[model samples]
Target: MKRLTAAAGSNLPVGPYSQAVISGNLVFTAGQIPVIPGQHIQPETFEQQVRQTLRNLETVLQAAGSDFDHVVKVNGYLTDPAQLEPYNRVYAEMLGHAPPARTTVCVSLWGVALEIECIAEVIDHRLRV
Candidate 1:
């Protein structure tokens, strides 16, 4: 059975989609932008936007019983090509040593600077040997 999840303390999805969906052991998250819930303070730089976007992704992952360490793939989209370098820096720091396989590209994203999405393994820690 498939399960849909919406992080309790995160921004509600502006569209019709749920924040994430879980099918069996996999959790697939919708694209996460830099809109922090209840906070109107927008990021002033690409790096800050990257941080907020990743945090949003984290919320979805946690709600799905996963985390960055369990992520298997990532797809990132930037509004400008120049944002890639700074984005990577923050991404590396957030994901640490076992970063997931990723593909990033520049695209027109309306007013947002960037977005990130991922697929993760939904591991139940207590069941692990």
Candidate 2:
């Protein structure tokens, strides 16, 4: 069975999609943008947006009974390729050793600077009945 999961305190979905969905041991998260709830604003700097996006991703993973440590793959989109260095710096710092396989690309985004999505392995103990 598949289950939809939403992170507590996270912003409501930007569209008709759940923050994450769990199927068996795998958790798939929808692309996370840097919009913070209540504020309705994305951070000013590219680095700040990257960090907020990662933090938002963390919330989705936790809601799915997983975390960055268990992420198996990551997909990131940046509006400009020039932002890659700063994005990498924050990503490396947050993921630390043994970071998951990642694919990042430059794409035109609407309003936001970047977006991030990931796949993670849900711990067996966290399976819901």
Candidate 3:
């Protein structure tokens, strides 16, 4: 198993935890919030926050040798049920047509509107012969 930090363009973890972990062919990412990388400031609008959070998730996935197409599962947390429609719109736009299995629920968050975490299969090109 290997632990990873946020990639170059992603925000550092706020607490004592790895941004992602690799085990064999799979990579699991920690929940990502909308705080700007290196700036620690979150975007004001919900859509902006969702996009930022997805960017952070993508950074971590790339660092783990994976991408959205390789993701197998996703867990999302939203502060309110009313945000679901907008969240789905942004999610569909970013994740493309064939998204992974997902579970999203209303929950309380610190200061952000939503958080996302995912599990993905790693693509180790070096192993190809």
Question: Candidate 3 — which residues are off by over 4 angstroms?
Answer: 125-129
Per-model TM-score on C-alpha atoms? 0.91, 0.93, 0.93
For model 2, residues 1-129, the per-residue Cα lDDT tens digits are 456646787878867788888877899999999987568899888899889999999987887789888999999999987999999999999996779999999999888999999999997555632
Clash pairs for candidate 3: none
Would you give me the overall lDDT of model 3?
A: 0.89
Candidate 3 lDDT, 1-129, residue by residue in tens: 888865677887779999998888899999999988888898888999999999989999998888998999999999999999989999999986779999999999988899999999999764212
> What's the candidate order when arranged by decreasing lDDT?
3, 2, 1
* Residue pairs in candidate 2 whose N, alpha carbon or C atoms collide under 3 angstroms: none
User: Which rank order by TM-score, best down to worst?
Assistant: 3, 2, 1
In model 2, the Cα lDDT at residue 1 comes to 47
RMSD per model, one decimal: 2.7, 1.5, 2.2
